[model samples]
Target chain A: EAGVAQSPRYKIIEKRQSVAFWCNPISGHATLYWYQQILGQGPKLLIQFQNNGVVDDSQLPKDRFSAERLKGVDSTLKIQPAKLEDSAVYLCASSLNFHGYTFGSGTRLTVV
Target chain B: ELKVEQNPLFLSMQEGKNYTIYCNYSTTSDRLYWYRQDPGKSLESLFVLLSNGAVKQEGRLMASLDTKARLSTLHITAAVHDLSATYFCAVDDSGAGSYQLTFGKGTKLSVIP
Candidate 1:
């Protein structure tokens, strides 16, 4: 079975520029999540989608970050006017239920 | 807001030593998950503890949960270099469904030869 897929593996963007990361979850997975993993810290959930409907997004920065899971299979996370603090690894994970979350390789975003 | 805390943020031990990492959460949860992550890599699921007194072991690692205390532990028996990695504990609230996970800061382990 294929695991969660994400691209590009790495991204470099200047401050004030916009960047986007894409994720394709495992087949038949019903839940998808986006997380930001800063250096030396655990991954923090930015948003969650359950079949194209948002389950939680309380931690996302509404003014700069946005995410959507169209058709409940693929998802996209976008950051506008990126800041230096936004540089981190963006991880996408999927699960059939509450167990066995499979994470993608993640996109390392560097905002200069 | 739910909070998860892991003890001994950094640990270094000689090979063959034994150690245990503790994870404590602030609220009741449906399940607790353990994940291992290497440097510059994504998370890999290790164990999922579903109920009180749940214990699961794989190789040299054992994970146990005490839901009544809202705590979990990952015990490493006869540690090896391959066990060196950041360990994270995450909690899923019962009513929050499957998407939200509250994660601890993580415990970084290093094994010496």
Candidate 2:
């Protein structure tokens, strides 16, 4: 059983630039989630998907952030016109149903 | 709104000592999860306490939940350097449908030999 996989362990971009993060969840997992973890803080849920459909994204910044899980197996989170406040670690996690969440290594974005 | 808080944000103790971290939530939840994360690393699942009075133990660590009190505790027995890391407690609010977790700020533990 492979763990959740994420791409681009680290990223650096200028303010107002666009950035995207990719996540490939573990096989057979039915739920996937994206979280933003600022330094010295807990991870905050950005979006959640059950299969190909979104379950919740109320906390997502509609004006700048968007996420999609097209085939239910992989997902992507994008931030357009990124801001300095958007510099944080983006973590992807997969679960059978909210019990044990297998997390990816995360993409650390640094916006200057 | 759901809020989770952990006590003693930082803990430093000698190896072989016993200590416990506490977690308190604002609302009712179906389950609570404990995770350990090393600096610059992803989180690792530690324990899941489901239902009131649920308890689980592994190695030198034990986790328990009290739904009525809306609290959870992670107890470390005879701690070791290997257990040094940031521990987080997350709650899954019932009826939220999201199954999204509300996490505490986390307790950073440092065990010295």
Candidate 3:
């Protein structure tokens, strides 16, 4: 089975600019998650999707960050007006009915 | 709210030594996972422990979960340089239903030769 796939392994954007990251989960998985990891800290959950429908986004900064998992297969996380603090690794992970999660390579974003 | 805490945020051990990393959670959860991550890399799952007293081992690393105490441990036996990486423990904070993981601040291990 293929692992979760992410695109644009790296990205650099100026503050207040917009950026998006893409992720393709493992085939047949029903749950997808987006996490943001800052330097020297643990990964924090940004959003969660259960087969296209959002299960949780409590931690997401709706004003700047938004995520969607369309068709219940692939997901995209976008950050508009990126802040310097937003410079971190954005990770995507998927699970089969909420078990055995596999993570993607992640997109390293640098907000200048 | 769910919170996970890992102790000794940094560990430096000599090769061929032994050490343990501890994870404590502040909620009721049965599913616990241990993941390893190298610099500039993604997380690699090492162990998934469900239920009380579940222990799993692979190579030089062993992981144990004690649900009664809301704690989990990753022990390194005869540590090797290859085992030097960040280790994280996550809990399915949704009580085994949603599987939304709440991760702990990772334990960074440096195995010196």
**Candidate 1's error at A5, in angstroms?**
0.2
Query: What ranking emerges by TM-score with the best candidate at the front?
Result: 3, 1, 2
lDDT of 2 by residue, A61-86 (tens): 99999999998899999999999999
Off by over 4 Å in 1: B97-99
lDDT of each: 0.92, 0.93, 0.93
Per-candidate TM equals 0.97, 0.96, 0.98
Question: Mind giving the per-residue lDDT tens digits that candidate 3 earns over A1-112?
Answer: 8999999899999999999999999999999999999988889999989999998898999999999888999999999989999999999999896668899999999999
Docking level for model 1: medium
lDDT of 2 at A71: 81
Report the lDDT tens digits of candidate 3 across residue range B30-112. 89999999999999999999889999999999999999899999999999899999999999887535679899999999999
What DockQ values do the models have?
0.78, 0.84, 0.87
For model 2, which pairs clash? none
- Backbone clashes under 3 angstroms, per model: 0, 0, 0
**Model 3, residue A84: what's the lDDT?**
99
The CAPRI category of model 2 is high
In CAPRI terms, model 3 is classed as high
Candidate 2 TM-score versus the reference = 0.96
Could you tell me how far off, in angstroms, the CA of residue B57 lies in candidate 1 after the best superposition?
A: 0.7
